[model samples]
Target chain A: MRGEAPRGAPNRLDLHDLSLFAGWDPGGRWRLFGEFELGEALVVREGRLRTDQREFDYERLYAEYDLRPDLKLRLGKFLTPVGRWNLIHADPLVWTTRRPLTTELPFAAHASGLSLLGEGAWHGGVFDYQLFVDDSLALDPDRGDRPLAGGAGMGLHDSFDHALGGRLHLLSADARDGLGASLAWFRRRGEAADRLLLGGDWHRRRGRLVLDSEAFYRFGRSADDWGGFLQAVARIHGGLHLVGRYEYIRSADLGAEGGAGLLGLTWRFHRAGVVKLGFQESAGPRVQPDGWILSYGLLY
Target chain B: MARGAYRSQVGLWSWPILAVLLMGISGGALAAAPGIAVVVHDPALAAGLDRASLARIYRRWQRIDTAGRPLVPVNLPADAPLRRAFTQALFRQSPEDMRGFWDERYFQGVSPPTVLASPEAVERFVRRTPGALGYLPDCRTPPDLVVALRLRWPRAAGIDPFGLCQEGD
Candidate 1:
């Protein structure tokens, strides 16, 4: 369920979505994965059901082959690894219902391409890297989806055929701490500005506390935008956590600056089930409504 | 003569009883401080492996072995005490604490270590499957299986987690 209430507006609630994930490794070296979601599966506003909101969305569909035990070749459409959150953005895996705009806004969040991915040990740490190229010929394009702040914003709707990107992450020996960097270049369908994006992310876990942050800067003839968010989660006890975040984005297209502060609690009652309740307040420009939000996500 | 014969008979009877008591005491001491042994099929593959490397292999982060072959790590049942001890000693984490990590890896098309029904099953699998790795109660570790790292967990913390122990011999 999702709830949003604009200033002086009545609060609205709706059944948010249902997602399906399938992964298959049928012996040998070939593998397949897919994730599909039924968005706005049901909606109720002013105590009445709305049927027009339901639609099917394909989030990821890809095929991978083992080039070696340490390397892989992936082909098809998959989540763009801009930072960290985009790769694991499923509601059940994240702590908050409101995604930080920095993660999604500056670039497209998903792309179709072939990628070379691998990881290895380095100086007692582990590093994984990926290099990918996406062309105009996409496997299955969701034109309705647009590039926004990793998760917030109303920015680009034009599709890009020539896109190239790479990401690298280094994790501590314990795998509890990591730092990541991402770079991408692309051209919009009708625009001449060649878009270039540079982003970085950090994650650290100390005892029961975790800290995550990501920032991005985008520059091109068509876009000049920068944004980021800092989030922290403290484990209150078993399966219960207190989450807090501050996010800000400056979109040249909107000609306005937007920022939001959120405080919430997440209860992971089961290993694959999570419930989040948060209250958010916005200052400057409004990217999203300021109100109470609740969502429940499950992975079956 | 009769007294001497009787004494000889009592002495003979007491020797076996004393031997049995001694054996019981030693066995009890061994049982009191059992450790977990990280085992592999080949001794060469056992080198350079410590608690951290074991943790990485089990986490699926280090997928390949020294020879560039995929490593197959196995685990006992989740509820097994040895499994708990192994994870705690190596990862400083509980199986419950790894749920989020596994969930993310699941989406990445990575799988958790294969779980066997028991330590005996783990031992069998490790011995039969090349590049297989597993852990067992030190006392249960077979001599033919190469012991890579010995972890004396919470129950046996008095002993060193990395030091050689007799059970793995």
Candidate 2:
């Protein structure tokens, strides 16, 4: 439900996503979860579909075993242990349909490997932690941002270059309030380039108000880039909410600086459906064409 | 002229009659609202829990207790009216909002609590399991059931439309 400038050529509706989420739990010893999406894009040249392309993507397909109530072992492809947005970016979960580039502009978002996830009580709160190591192929970062599933998202990896990462989360005892930090290191084949990233996130929800934000910085041999977003949502009434978001990015590598302020209102009038309208204004040199979105989305 | 006067009299009296009928329906609904009780297998494990702890337990966001015991929260069937009342009283969330929350959590490799066949089944499960916690529609208090908390109906119903259930209350 996002339209760009001049003619709204690359309008978001040019693509469609048919998605499914399923899970099975057997007596608490083991659990299974899968999220799949089939995307069809117009493959347009001007305003017409020159050809159509189809892709089936498995965003998450993993089996987890609870070795302990506070800890679990999971094997398969999962969202990288990075930031809040990556884990909860699905259309039905996020506050806005428009995504911030900071979340996806660098590094592939998926990791295929074994992960150790654990949580325990701490003081007046709890701290959750995850460590991941993967040597799997990733869809290029830019492609993963679009709705078009870039490749057969379900796969095995033959290339043996490994990256290790982890995230630590400390939250209030209730788990509604928290802070998180993440870091990852990856040096591609023969030390051709070294890439490292650091990120932090915070979220708090009280009564009718919710606030969450995340920041990410990538350090490279030659150029450094950083980006972040801050957002809040206030529930005004039953199933009605007002939301505001600010997104910023500075890329020395791409020599680009940009930001956008977005405000939206949503009416969750239906059980699983919402109608949302949002307006965004761009800032900086890139002149991100100001736009508005009116759309309906559902979880089911 | 007498027939016209009689029709006017019926119209004038019908408003109060309808009001009385509506009051009856509402009163019946309120009286029928199911009372809810937090039940645990062991009475000793009930301490350190309040509304916040209750919400997290049912949400499956927190799966352990204060003393680090693995807590397994059971629930009644999804469509049970009593279950709706319990969810409303605790989470202040509609059934659909909950389904969506569970779906999102599933993709995160987190599973929701188990749904037992009936509230009686939930009561029985909590009795059999060491670290089990659950809710029942009434405070009947089965032979082995321990009621950690109980809420009178109507007032305890999702009366607080916002998500935060009064924590200590």
Candidate 1 — which pairs collide?
A: A103-A150, A104-A148, A104-A149, A104-A150, A105-A148, A105-A149, A105-A150, A136-A161
| lDDT by candidate, in order shown | 0.77, 0.69
lDDT of 2 by residue, B1-169 (tens): 9999999999999999999999999998676544677899867667666765676677676666655566788877777656777776675545544665676675575767888987668877998998898886553446567878765543434443222222223
Worst 10 residues of 1 chain A by lDDT: A144-153
Error of 1 at B84 (Å): 3.4
**After superposing candidate 1, which stretches have Cα over 4 Å from the reference?**
A8-10, A136-138, A141-155, A158-160, A188-192, B1-36, B41-56, B61-71, B88-92, B129-131, B146-169
lDDT value, candidate 1, whole model: 0.77
Q: Which CAPRI quality tier does the interface of model 1 achieve?
A: acceptable
Clashes of each: 8, 0
Error of 1 at A87 (Å): 1.0
Question: Could you estimate the TM-score for every candidate?
Answer: 0.81, 0.69
List, residue by residue over A1-300, the lDDT tens digit for candidate 1: 677665666667777777777888664467788888787777877777897978776677889877765677889878787799988887888999887777755666777878888877766677889888887435545543444422234555435556899999998765689999999998654445778989999999889899999998889675588888999999999999999999988877557687889999999999878899999897744556677888888876
Q: What is the fraction of true interface contacts found in candidate 2?
A: 0.15
Q: Write the per-residue lDDT of candidate 1 for residues B1-169, one digit (tens) a residue.
A: 9999999999999999999999999988766666788999767678867655676688776666655666789988776777777877776567766777899987666789999997778888988988889998786677888999888666522334334333244
Q: For this target, which candidate reaches the highest DockQ against the unseen true structure? A: 1
